[model samples]
Target: MSTVLAIAKRELKSYFATPIAAVFLVVFVVLCGVFTFQVGRLFDRGVADLAPFFNYLPWLFLILIPAVAMRLWAEERKSGTIELLMTLPVSPGEAVTGKWLAGTLFVALALVLTFPMWITVNILGDPDNGVILANYIAALALASVFLALGGCASAFTRNQVVALVLSVVGCFILLTAGMPLVLDAISGYVPTAIIDAVRSISALSHFTSIARGVLLVPDLVWVVSMVVFWLFATVAVISLKKAD
Candidate 1:
């Protein structure tokens, strides 16, 4: 546990050591403002809640989160630093968990920086703070899923660009799986059970449910299970690579 925390702290500090942290924070905050105010037309809705902001989060994260995850292992492998990392006293699982923890915390910080949106909605009208809180929790969970997927993708290759593309494609599939359009397209061609399974596995469905303050046990379970599965895959991939 101490080793994991130490690695996590080291990784988190590495993020700030480069311009990556600043660039990501600036781009994310700016894009959130654009999507919420300009594209989403928050004023047009005349709503007190941050529905507009939350609605665009998955799409925003689809691109940005992968960018963050691409360097988790891909860069290390590309630079031949994975050899040095492997020589450490840490197990692959501990290393994977530590890196994932750092990435998740960094994304959480990005989410926290969006608190002004919550304040803005509050100033405008009597918004349900509870719903907003739930939405934030859902967003964090969704981000963790993306980060884990990205990390798993990163473990598959030595090239950061390949990792980024794989991560984005994987995230996109999961994001759209539960959408009405996707479901309708597959409904007749696919079996009902398969269709239902796809929808159930979609990150978007669970995110939307929690974003609406419907924080059920199933939704939480899905989030935890997805994160765990992807992280587990990441650890396995790293272990295989180490053996080879």
Candidate 2:
């Protein structure tokens, strides 16, 4: 546990050691503002809640999370530092978990910086704070899922660009699985059962469920399971690369 924390701390500090942290945070906050105010037209809706903001989160994360995660293991492998990392006392599982933790926390910090949106909605109207809180929780869960998937993709290749592209494509598939357009397109050719299964596994569906302020046990389970599965996959990929 201590070793894992040490790795996580080191990885987290590495983000701030460069300009990546500043650039990512600034872009994230600015995009949130644009999406919420310009694209979403929050004031036009006249709703007391942050539905507009939450609605755009998955799409925002689809791009940004991969950017953050593309370097998890890909950069180390690319720079021939994975050998040095493997020489340490840490196991692949610990390294994967630690790096994932760092990435998740970094994304969470970006989310926190968007608190002004919540404040704006409150001052404009008597929004349901409970629902807003639930949306924040759902957003964090969604970000974690993306981070894990991106990290898993990073473990598969030494090229960060390849990792980023793979992560984006993989995340996009899961995200759009529950969309009406995707479901309708497949409904005619695919079996109903398979379509239902695809929708059931959609990250967007679960995110919407929780964002609606009804955090069901099933939704929580799905989030935790996805994160765990991807983290485990990342560890396995790293192990294979280490053996090669």
The C-alpha lDDT values of all candidates are: 0.93, 0.91
- Candidate 1: lDDT of 118? 87
C-alpha root-mean-square deviation, each candidate: 1.4, 1.4
**Model 1 C-alpha lDDT versus the unseen true structure:** 0.93
Query: Which regions of candidate 2 fall more than 4 Å away from where they truly are?
Result: 188-190
lDDT of 1 by residue, 144-167 (tens): 999999999999999889999999
**Tens-digit lDDT string for candidate 2 (96-119):** 999999998998899899999999
* Stretches of model 1 off by over 4 angstroms after superposition: none
lDDT of 2: 0.91
